[model samples]
Target: MTISLHRSATVLFQGDSITEVGRLVEPDSPLGNGYARKAADRVRSARPDSGITFVNRGVGGDRIADLRARWREDALELRPDVVSVLIGVNDTWRRYCSGSVTSARAFEDDYRAILTQVRDELDAQLILIEPFLVPVRDEQWAWREDLDPRIQTVRRLSQEFGAALLAADGLLNQAARAAGGAEHIAGDGVHPTPLGHTLLAEAWAALAGL
Candidate 1:
């Protein structure tokens, strides 16, 4: 059965650019212009009386290390009941593009540290979204070698932590295949388009039973 969020629960989303998507840092509009926002909207629409609160702390270009640096401030401090995280793509991207490689072991360690902190400090329910690549460009196919292991790592960690796992990669791939191609979902192979974000929001809502 899908997990149901309690009433008045605070939900937090943490990740990279895909999750960031030009979100306002100001108090008024916290959840960005991506799937996070869409998901929030859907939840409110589905349960207008739930009084659930949502926060988006996703920063563009963030990797696992970056999240580690700001975990206390962005995540723990908020004391959210549910924390949804989408990361790791930038870790893989930096290796190929900038030669700033983060080995799989290191990635898992850093990630586990964040999860451990959340578990110990807040005891919040976790939703781990796997990092995905659509391979819209031929060169993007090579990213599979690095990203796949990280995805597996996330799956293992989710089970270990009793977190809900959102299989975004496979879901998006299937959407892409039905919707003509990856370009329709994520034109850049990394970031999702409006249609892609909608798919993501729907997937999260369904998986989390929001």
Candidate 2:
């Protein structure tokens, strides 16, 4: 079933670079040029009088631990009615590139902690987006071993927390196949292109029933 947003609700998007998309940190029009912006636009267009306010707090290079560290200020205090989170890639990426490894267990723990806080602090709905890689570069295929488990963790936690899950990995993979190749969707296998963001927005809208 599609989750419906209440009128005058505050919707918050949280995650890493994909969600950030250069969003302004200030109060006015914070959604950046990414899926969050696209999704917010669609929802507002569909119901201009819904009185839904959107906020983006996604920072580049954030891992689950980073999110846990800032949850109180960036999320809880906002008193959002709906929260959407897309994270975990950096947790796996840093291990391969920067040698800063965050194990799957730690990732799950931090993620759960954030969700627990949200559940205890507010009557907010949750949407968890799955972390994905497109394998645009041959070396990127190797990231699956690390990212796959984190993806599973998100799926399990979403169920545990009664949150909606967006199967972004599978959705983007299908989009890549249809669009001719992975590079067409995500040029570097991690960050998404405009078309990739569109796919994400459409998938999010379909999942949220906006």
Candidate 3:
């Protein structure tokens, strides 16, 4: 029988700026102000009869290495039934502006390490959110070369880890095509707009089959 969302299920969202969305900084605050909120809203709306708990732990400017640093506290400790992660953009962004260059191989290595630990130590179902870029600016246009592989790694890792995969990037790309261009969904190409958040929630809900 297919499992349905229930009070026993706890969902956690983990990522960088896009996921954080300026949520309540206090540890007391669970869902932040961005796509995390939208995602939570969609889950709640779909399963109003279910009592699943949702938490968002996205931090701005984080990369795979950063996530590796806080894997225990931010994730494993939470003991979620479902865990979702969106990252990688910063791994590329820092290379250009912050002078921190993480090669594709290194990025994948870091990501693998983090997920490996999570799989070994945690009891949650994993959900990998694909990192995306739309090239709103010239600098961002070049980010694809560095970001694509990391995104692909997430896809492969999800299958390897027996996790759910939410195609947030592809959904955004579709929205860009429908609305006009990437700028409409992601103003700066890294951060998403309100519509973009909605699209993310929709895609996530669909993937969750909720």
Candidate 4:
């Protein structure tokens, strides 16, 4: 199930390039032009008096291990009321682009550490987004072998932690089939197009009760 955000909730979105989306590039735009901003903006506009603050600390090229390495500084320090994580795709991308690969076991271990810390140290809620794929090409279909495990891991973790789950994987697949082609969503089969971001943002906002 999803979460109903409170009035003073501070939502922090964490993950890789998909979540980062050039957030650090422009001086005025700290949240970047992606789902994180879109979702937060939706909530902020709907509830102008919410007093809810949203922070984006996502870094490009970060995998589960990378997030683990920096969680204490980026996440724990922020002390957000709600932590939303969107990782694991790069853990599969690296295996195809480079030789680097993160086993599902390592991914789960690192992911668990961060969640455990949050449970123990902070009074916070968790929102875990599934790493999705909309393969435009035939070869990209093979990525399921690497990505499916991680997606399953996130699903399992969400249930284990009783956190709000954003079921992005199946949504994207449905979008790719019903609305438009995969390219209309994620041209590179990884990075999202504007339409893709909007779709994800709408789903996230619904899940977060924003």
The best candidate by lDDT is 1
Clashes in each model (backbone N, CA, C under 3 Å)?
Answer: 0, 0, 1, 0
Question: Over 4 Å off in model 3, which ranges?
Answer: 1-4, 24-29
| Tens-digit lDDT track of model 3 for 85-122 | 89988988888887898888887888888788777887
When 1 and 2 are scored with lDDT, the better candidate is: 1
Where in model 1 is the C-alpha error above 4 Å? Answer: 25-28
lDDT to native, each model: 0.93, 0.92, 0.81, 0.91
Q: What is candidate 2's CA lDDT for residue 138?
A: 82
lDDT per residue, candidate 2, 1-210, as tens digits?
Answer: 356798999999999999998875545557988999999999999889999999999999899999899999999999999999999999999999989999999999999999999999896899999999998888888899999999999999989989999999999999999999999999889999999999999988887786
Q: TM-score per candidate, in order?
A: 0.96, 0.96, 0.91, 0.97
- C-alpha root-mean-square deviation, each candidate: 1.3, 1.4, 2.3, 0.9
Q: How much lDDT does candidate 4 score?
A: 0.91
Q: Which ten residues in a row have the lowest lDDT in candidate 2?
A: 21-30
- Scored by lDDT, model 3 comes in at 0.81
- What is residue 154's positional error in candidate 1, in angstroms? 0.3
lDDT of 4 by residue, 1-210 (tens): 778789888999999989988898876878988999999999999999989999999999899998999999999999999999999999998999898989989999999899999999996899999998899889899999999999999999999998889989898888888866999888988888999999999999898665
Candidate that beats the other on TM-score, 2 or 3, i.e. the better one: 2
